[model samples]
Target chain A: MRDRLSFYILRESPIHRMNPLTKLTLVFSLILLAFLGPVEWLAILLFTTVILPLSFLAHVGREFLSATARLLLPVIGFLFVMQSIFLPGGGTALVQVWVLDITLENVNIAFVNATRILTMISSFLLLLLTTHPSALMSDLARRGVPGPISYTVTSTLQILPQMQVKAATIMDAQRARGLETQGNLMKRIRALLPLVAPLVFGSLVDVEERAIAIEARAFNSPRQKTSLVEIDDRPIDRRIRWGLILVVIFLLGSRLWLK
Target chain B: MAQVTINNLTYTYPLTEEPALREISIEIQAGEFLAVIGANGAGKTTLCYTLSGFIPHFFRGELQGKILIDGLDTANSKLYEIVEKVGLAFQNPFNQISGSKFTVYEEIAFGLENLGLPRDEIRSRVEWILALTGIEDLAERSPYALSGGQQQKVALASILVMKPGVLVLDEPTSQLDPIGTREVFQVIRSLAHSGQTIILAEHKMEWIAEFADRVLVLDKGEIVRLGTPQQVLSDINLLSSGIGLSRYTRVAHRVNQQKLWPKGQRYPISLQEATEAFGRLLSQEGGSKK
Candidate 1:
């Protein structure tokens, strides 16, 4: 397992320096424009023109493309293939196979659907890569988000990796004692019980102590909490955020107007 | 003036019949280092929680009587308000980590940020605490990626940065190795010497004997003995109560029983005192032989 669950890659580019909220707004705008805009191939257009270029500007172009290929391509590819064969609204058949017909209309619709999903995932992946989770949570919390909600999001990002490490340790320990974790299905299933019990109970106890620990740090203090890292919401960031919002509104509104 | 005052305090945890602490009363002066020693289930942790305002505020227990910090009733004050006056660092350094912070520097600043301090103030305080706890080099390191000892020091620094008037430690080194335990004790010893009002629950009797201004021994859920470390740590009855004496005191007791030690002399609680007493005995024997 990866040592950490965060997608953030630290770099000194303009995109990395953008306000987290602005980047978040950009991601949401791209997604809405792709899925809800009144234009065919808008998803593919946004992927090539906006998201892909932004990834390079952020200096994570290589990582972004690899992540998209590794993580998103398979899911989108599967969806495209499955929907092309199974979706029932196509009229013109492009090819015939035994008892099934691959229709041209179905292929077109699946491509559109797949590109929309690809655009959505890749945009979000770009945001995660550029902005640190804590910085995002801090900016959100500063903008009047509830403290506990922000805390839950940030802490989960860190805790998941620690939990994975703990699980691995427990698995190794049980294996050393001759617990059959590798063989057939039943053996692996039985091995899971021993591995799971300690992790769950141990974590539950840690939760109690953790709750006390944070409270001691005044986590629930009824005061305006400040952040140590100052996330700069520059004038350019503000303009970008407003521009994204307007674009999203225009896209959605024009789609409604056209309909 | 007493910085902490507990009067006839009793507390039972939620869903439990037995009170974790019962009729416990004590007055601790400001800047005094008070050490608490007890066997398992003897309410050492419970007392630490009580002092830190967790027993009634966080645990939601059946609390009777009063605990006052700087004359502020803990039962009336909010947990946050109490936390401002008393900082608590417990065992299990891993669990004590806020987990929200990525770096050791940010982790220590977590408490200050919660208090709504300015960014510059938070930075200065965190930097100061990192140096004080001797984890300045580990400031940029991940809080999760540290040895148990380093994590424990980070935990202590996180609380210390708040500059709480009273520091409550509940067996802070219980989960550490000997090296880790010593590292933690060194920090605590320095804090004690700086005259921080500290109430530490610990099992390391030798360290307590050397550093604690007074020692309080608890049995079950009540205080059985409270006095200077020399008076309380050397008490023979503490053995029957299951609170073991320091090794020096135990050896002195054994030798006193054999009449090798001076009659009615107090048992030594530290290595330095033990060495002096033994040296005096050997010299007197040598003079007699000559």
Candidate 2:
């Protein structure tokens, strides 16, 4: 696992400068348009034209493409192969692989399904690659998201990495004491008990201390919280958000008309 | 008027038969530096939690008596209100980080942001505290990536940025290395010099002697001694109680046992005082020989 959990790349680009909620709206709109729009090729078309170009605009094109290929390609590729061969309702047979019959209609259906999943995940990746998690949470909190919810999201982003590091240290300590972590399955399973016990209890103690720490800082203060890093909700951002909403509505309308 | 008053205070943690603290009464004046010294489980941490309004509010323990800050009882006031009056920093620096903010600067601003300060005000206060704590260079670094010392300084700055009426630190340097210990103590000394009312629970007797106006000793949740650092830290009997005296005092007590130390001379609690007393004794011996 990566040392840090954030996908955000620190670079100055138009996409990076946009408001987090605006980017969030854009991602959701793209996902909705892909799933609800009345065309089989629409998801793949949006992924290529919109998401790819936006990644470059955000200056995270290389990271975004590589991350998508590395993280999502296997799942999508597996789904396409499996569904194209096993799905049972096609009249024309494309090919025969041993006992399975690959059909033309099933291949088309699988392609649409895989590309839709790709579109949904890639849009979110674009948003995460551009926006800091805490910045997003802060904006959401300012716009009426409860304090605890936002705190949980942002704190988890940071704390998970620290906990991972702590877990590694505990594992190393246990191994040094001859706990046998790298042998037969039973040995590894037994090693998990020693490794997990300390990590869980230690994290529990950290949780209590962290709770007190945040409480001491007035985390639950009965006041409207303010943010230090001001997220710019520019007029242009508002217009873009509205424009995305309209596009989504138009896509839904078109789907209804086609039906 | 006392800035903090703990009148006949006693506390028992949840599900525990023994009380963590008993009959703990003390009045701390504004801007006075009070140091509490005790053995493990001697109620130092418990007293700190009570002072900072974490005992009954956060910990939800059975508490007796009262703790008042600036004429407001902590039991009656909300934790947020009490936090405004008294800021708390504890031992584990890693745990104190809010974990929400990425940078040390933003971490320090977390508390002020929660207080609902305006953007410009938060920026200015965070900047001022960063400079004060001497962590200005670490401003943009992630709080998680910082060393224990830097993280503790950030923790202190985070609380100090709120500008609370009183500061309560519970063994703030216990987990730090020698350099880290010095770095944290320097910040605490600066805060104390700036007339911040501070109640620090500490084990570093030598450093406490230099800054603390009074030292309170606890043994088994009872106040065993309360006096100036000289009076409390120099008491030889404190060693038997598991709260060891300062090295200077121990050395002097060892010398006094051999009749080498001058009669009627009080034991020293710091290196400078120890050297001065020994210097005087050497000169007297030189004069007698002449």
The prediction achieving the highest DockQ against the true structure is 1
Per-residue C-alpha lDDT of model 1 across residues B115-167, encoded as one tens digit per residue: 99999999999988888889899998999999999999999999999999999
TM-score for each predicted model, relative to the true structure: 0.97, 0.96
The parts of candidate 1 lying over 4 Å away from their true place are: A1-3, B257-259
Candidate DockQ scores, in order: 0.75, 0.70
lDDT of 2 by residue, B1-290 (tens): 89898899989999999999999999999999999999999999999999998889889879999988999899988999999999999999999999888888889999988999999999999989989999999998998888899999999999999999999999999999999999999999999999999999999999999999999999999999999998888899998779977888988999999999878879988989988988898899999999
**What value does the TM-score of chain B take for model 1?**
0.97
Q: Clash pairs of candidate 2?
A: none
Q: Give the candidate number with the greatest TM-score.
A: 1
Candidate 2 versus truth, CA RMSD in Å, comes to 1.7
List the pairs of residues colliding in candidate 1: none
Listed per model, the TM-scores of chain A against the true chain A are 0.95, 0.94
